[model samples]
Target: MVSHGFSAIRYETEVKTNGLSSVLMAKCQGCHQKFKFETSPQLLNNRNKSKHYDVNVRAVWGSMATRGGLAHLNESLATLNSPGMSQQTYTTIEQEIGNMWGEVVEEDLLKAGAEERKIAMEKGQFHEGVPCITVICDGGGVKEHTNIHTMRLEGYANSKGTLPTQHVCYKNWDESSQAMESNIILEGFLKAET
Candidate 1:
């Protein structure tokens, strides 16, 4: 006789691309709406991650402050690093500081938000929320070990129409080839969607 171990796994997925697909339903439920559309892919890989760049921006700033040419900039930066600076003033100072520290590159955080908005526009999710298509997968029985896996949508259907979006992301996996599935880390979209 074989004993089956009890197991449960959970994970959240995001619409990386935010685009929609045409889920035509000439017949849905008890109605014949004959609806047609261009749906967006519903998965992490498809979801666009422009906002993530802001994180990079911060990391870059921190790293720059501690390294080479920009190393000395830290002292100057400390003066303006108070917690009481007005939001507006802090932003201006931060950007200036970033530039003065290194290449400066892009400054305004609002501008960064705009960049994310642009990507959301392409996916039609900038305004309207994307719908999630769910599939109950029967994962094999779990024993002393747990495995993680990410599922990417190759195609999708929605109200607009169908189109292919190029993107990929880590959805779920066994956590770095370890049976330690108890400690799951969802840094970004890896987070559970509400």
Candidate 2:
């Protein structure tokens, strides 16, 4: 007679993680079988040719949305008894995000400039054979003695009531807050000339 044997097999599990993503790996002691499971998909970073977990990028993005940094993210993770990312990893992700934003900002500025020029051309607003768009400058700073200042330049639609103002330039000033407006205006005009 043939007899079937029943036995309980043991498996060892290990977790590997990056940021909010984790991978569960298991190995069967008897059969030596291995299995792996991922909590998040890995994404490719085009600029650096590196791979990153999707959740890791999302976590950094969420931190940036709240204007927080690595410390803040770590604090939140610590409360949940989760491991925090290394500073080097955080910096790499932050730099990648910053680079992406820089490209977007440049594209937006170019589009805004193009739209302003088109509006000026349609209205026949020309000076010395160059299309001249009306630009409105505004600046503000803290009420206190802080020297920090911010300025924005908007392309005004003027007589065209249907068209809204388009932002052309935004800049931060390190000089006296009171004097920032004039400086920013001058800088805006200089930039337009080029």
What TM-score do all the candidates reach, one by one?
0.16, 0.68
- Model 1: residues >4 Å from true position, as ranges? 1-64, 67-108, 127-194
Ten-residue region with minimum lDDT total, candidate 2:
146-155
Range of the 10 consecutive residues with the lowest summed lDDT in candidate 1: 146-155
Among these predictions, the greatest lDDT belongs to 2
CA RMSD per model (angstroms): 29.8, 13.5
Best by TM-score: 2
Residue by residue across 1-194, what tens digits does model 1's lDDT show?
A: 12255222222222222111223323233332344432332222122321222322343345334432122333444566611222232233344444454433334544654566676666666324643322232333323221111121322323336543432222344344333233322232245343
lDDT of 1 at 74: 34
Look at candidate 2 and tell me the lDDT of residue 120: 94
